[model samples]
Target: MILRRFFSSSFRLVSSSSSSSSSKLGGGCHRDGFRAVSSMPEPCQSSPLSDDESCDFDWDSLGFGLMPTDYMYIMKCSKDGKFERGQMSRYGNIELSPSAGVLNYGQGLFEGLKAYRKRDGGFRLFRPDQNALRMMTGAERMCMPSPSIEQFVDAVKQITIANRRWVPPLGKGSLYIRPLLIGTGPVLGLAPAPEYTFLIYASPVRNYFKEGSAPLNLYVENEFVRASRGGTGGVKTISNYAPVLKAITRAKSRGFSDVLYLDSVNKRDLEEVSSCNIFLVKGNVISTPATNGTILPGVTRKSIIEIARDRGYEVEERAINMEELFDAHEVFCTGTAVGVAPVGSITCMDRRIEYQTGADTTCQELYSTLVGIQTGTIEDKMGWTVEIS
Candidate 1:
């Protein structure tokens, strides 16, 4: 009945409620006049699964990998056009030309967030509006049009509701939602694409690291860096991620969980990990690398900072050096995937320092409060979560 109610009248909620001028376009897909969306009727929904029933797949073994769901939300527009409307379709490959800007020039952006099945069997999303705003920022930097914040959040909710059955049972994991904005149209010149597409897909995922919730062993990379000043590093673009693969691969081969990149210019100050943000805790003070045109401002990192400040911890956002990092009493990593993970040890060159982990530590307390607020175990005093239903 929830699915039925969603599809029947509120399916057009984004289009009908939007006041942006982009909503003026006709509600249909037209890919540069080359193709049109399929006109077939949407598949009928089956009876809702009861709480006693389990998923078809093994829920206990869920990991941070792609496990395709039943549906995805897609919307398309020209480079100069606006994101008007989108629809949910079956999950499958999309058609693209060899000259597409995304393939040729790497014009794309992506955002990650998750939906947790609460203890009472309802679903909640953690600060998806922030993800939408971040995606809009990335779209502007990548030279592409973006969905309005309302549209982006609505599409995410639509896709989640469409694939609600795929959401892992409470505490097992969560449905990891990925929203992608890409240049889909052909381009022969070294410029922005003539068209773009906004797509959202999801998978049920558990811990990002193989070690589960255990503390991580990180390697400080002096040879490679993740981002720099006045670059796409500040924005979440496709081009910012691939260049760090070699460094991450090399670190993993050396038995480290991940690599901690430094400022490319100085190669001394802390930057971030391969896919997450880093935090250093010394005494009662918590410090993290500032987002000064070189660090990707993580949503989890922002939330954790506020939560820490609310809990009477002194939080600082500024440049942090490797020496200070090594001297810190505790360190932790935050991201949509990693959540809040304590860093057990950091190996810089030949010097290795292990931090305090496990119960009664600052990392443990923050992790508990963060996850508790997310999963509805604790009060959401900050009003950060959005209920899916």
Candidate 2:
């Protein structure tokens, strides 16, 4: 069993905090039930620049990379099988061994979500509870400890409140929240580690574009299997990601943003993307690959299905074979990062199937509606929105 860590040196041992009047991430920066000690134990190395440089990065010229923030949230879990809640601090480098469990065996899981300043000029999280639940599911699958949903959500809020300046205005951009967990126990044996690290950080980001307002051009490889029956496909583990990195890079070189994977067995049915879940629109019905224990149950994917249904669209959760989606009116992917992305074409060995990409379509409607709710422009009748105080 070979495991791999996401970053070469992402671990940072820190002990400190700055001034506490940060923005409200879903964590409710000032909640008293779960107190976030605004204290620091370690000095920060990556000292932050002036507030102008930190928050005034061209939101339009953004790419996916870490822009140093004022702080982060981290907590430790002991080998005695007990853990403690966390607090916020300055964002900087992490300290880990060259042979940490996450480095050797890849025992880890993570989650992605964001905080956005609403039209009313306040911050909000779109169904962050869903992210908390997904993180727990990933934890269970990785054999790692799970942070309580409340604690998890609160940590995010505290960190966001501390870094509120980064939360983009309603139409400009958004603050990206990354809650990461990895096994920290040290050993040479290829086994699950008893200790792990759970940390949540934020990055301000712009939109993830697919192609000229239409669906994406994806290459379907029938030979490579992403996740097997009983494998950790549904779990968002760091290990689950490394295996697909090569495949994804290869696909990108071939003019694709991502690769559409098949089930580990038959190589016929669809699984999901390297990072997001897939969906198909056929007539008035909607379908996505069922969980079947081999796909990540994305928070946005679930919410889209529910929102579409409430708007009177039919949805199906079952095996979605390659043939079915290739013939779909539209194929899109969903996750906290990209929101909902449309796939316009699927490239096989010698052929490519194309569909409508971005105009008046079901996927776009869903995307717009979902974004609206997150930015507080749409009525959140389902009560999924969590407003930060």
TM-score of each: 0.90, 0.84
**lDDT tens digits by residue: candidate 2, 52-93:** 323545666665566656667776564344445465545656
| lDDT of the structure predicted as candidate 1 | 0.82
The lDDT values for all models are 0.82, 0.72
* Poorest lDDT segment (10 consecutive residues) of candidate 1: 10-19
Task: Residues 233-272, candidate 1: write the lDDT tens digits.
Answer: 9888989989999998998999999999999988989999
Candidate 1: list runs displaced more than 4 Å: 1-30, 33-54, 78-80
